[model samples]
Target: MLGSLFQKFKDGLRKNTPTFQKFFGKVGGLFAAKLDAATIDELEEALFAADFGVETTEEILGEIRAAYRNNKDLRGQDAAKIGATVLSRVLEGAEGQFSPNPEHHPEVIALIGVNGAGKTTTAAKLAWRLQQEGQKVILGACDTFRAAANAQINTWAERLNVEIVSSQHGADSAAVAYDTLQAAKSRGYNVAILDTAGRLHTKGHLLEELKKLGRVVQKLDTSAPHHRWLVVDGSLGSNSIEQARVFHESFGLTGLVITKLDGTSRGGALVGIYRSLKLPVYFVGLGEKPEDLQPFSTTAYVEALFG
Candidate 1:
């Protein structure tokens, strides 16, 4: 069902990545002619319009100017080629994958985010991906305070044929987390994916609830809840970076998962977030399905974005 659909979405992401097309459009015609003052001005507006942020745009363009100066013969499409290489170079090493060591088998990854950040869906996607890798996974529905938290995860649990440790609505979420870890440990699940409450960092009580769950998990296994993933909606643009900064302060995030890449024009925020946070981007969600999640790859991402 979703598995097959997600495969298509991931394929489409690579084929029609927004970043690649944006860059190609901006530098395409300008660099199609010999390098000149006019072309450089056009390129400047393009970088700013692309939402690369002022500093980043300046940094990339500065590199391009240096490259052009060194090689006076570079013109036309070749000029654009050098410019693209410059952008890719600045974006190098930003791609990465989120992989928890099995040494902490039955490792716990606490997925944290505000509501609508695709927290529930990401958890399901991650569990499915881990299962495909031959790891036994258990899900913990610790978002009991939400109306649909348990139901959302239950749908995924059924689809994945995995066990879920959950309690009735309004139950103490930390208690559910405590029990889930115990159950996962006893059952020998290689990974425990904990679906925590989705609350904005500014929400005092809810943020504390997330901390309580983390504390409970740690009591069970000092390093349990080994990784904390902050899921951000890609469309938020500049606001997304602020969210990451806020959440990171509150949760001590270990990684990030930006969702809804297929629907947003501000995909440029991906670059902004990376430059600002410098944290590991464990995965990104392209659609609603479980398999739409993918590990971060800076080179492939920039290539896809500019195409």
Candidate 2:
């Protein structure tokens, strides 16, 4: 299952292949000849172009430098192997698998991100995926502020055949969230995915509204909102890292769902975001279909990049 999923992910990442090929191709040349300062500089430039972020790129470079120092005979493929290992090490810690704890009935997952990050669609896709796994799920259309946000979620609810709780436009979003959880408990749904209003992390008022929504959920169950996920646009590259940082600081985001990986060459930003934030990436959006949102696999992701 994971192999198939990885292939889909690799297919979505075709745009990035040439970049990785060129990067590894240069490194291969360096190793074929003699590892020198010029070779290291060239590798650094490639990583920067790949949008690996400064800190992560430097760490990768440091790892290669140390490996070369330790083993003077290290070849290009060896360097690539070391790079993959270093990348994997950075993404370790957070569990990629997401299953609701039966004990925590109606596991609440709050999806948060800026406008146009694909939160509503991702909520629908997640509901579809969880339902495929035989878990009863409900969606909370808490994004009342966005015009037609409730309508969009309602449409998805009907198509997915899942229960959804929503209110009229301009309603208090916190109230919608509260009622959604209430309905989830009453209906015995295993998962309650709340679709919060998309807001810029820079907006203080909007951030406060998000905090209010969390508080409302906590009112029912303190440990509720079991997962706080940030749906980010992978195409945003390094900007996505800043967005993640702000959201993490504001809400203590538990995981990430990076969308639009299929459309951009900035997929390397995944490594930088995961490395800097140390948050598990639960799923990656490769395409528009429901199944395109595949579970994130470290091995698959690294191989897709270096291959």
lDDT of each: 0.73, 0.82
Tell me the tens digit of each residue's lDDT in model 1 across 1-307.
4344334433454344443333354444433456666666666665555556777777767766787788765554554465557657765656555555768857898888878888888888888988888888888898898768789899888987878888999899999989988998788887888888876345778778888888888888988788888888876665778878877898888888888876555565677787788777778787776667877665555544443
Instruction: Show the colliding residue pairs in model 1.
Output: 19-305, 19-306, 20-305, 20-306, 20-307, 21-306, 21-307, 95-298, 106-190
TM-scores of the candidates in the order shown: 0.84, 0.88
Worst lDDT run of 10 residues, candidate 2, spans 22-31
Off by over 4 Å in 1: 1-36, 69-93, 200-202
Report the lDDT tens digits of candidate 2 across residue range 202-235.
5787789999999999999999889999999988
Name the weakest run of 10 consecutive residues (lDDT summed) in model 1: 14-23
Pairs that collide in candidate 2 are none
**Highest lDDT: which candidate?**
2
TM-score of 2: 0.88
Scored by lDDT, model 2 comes in at: 0.82
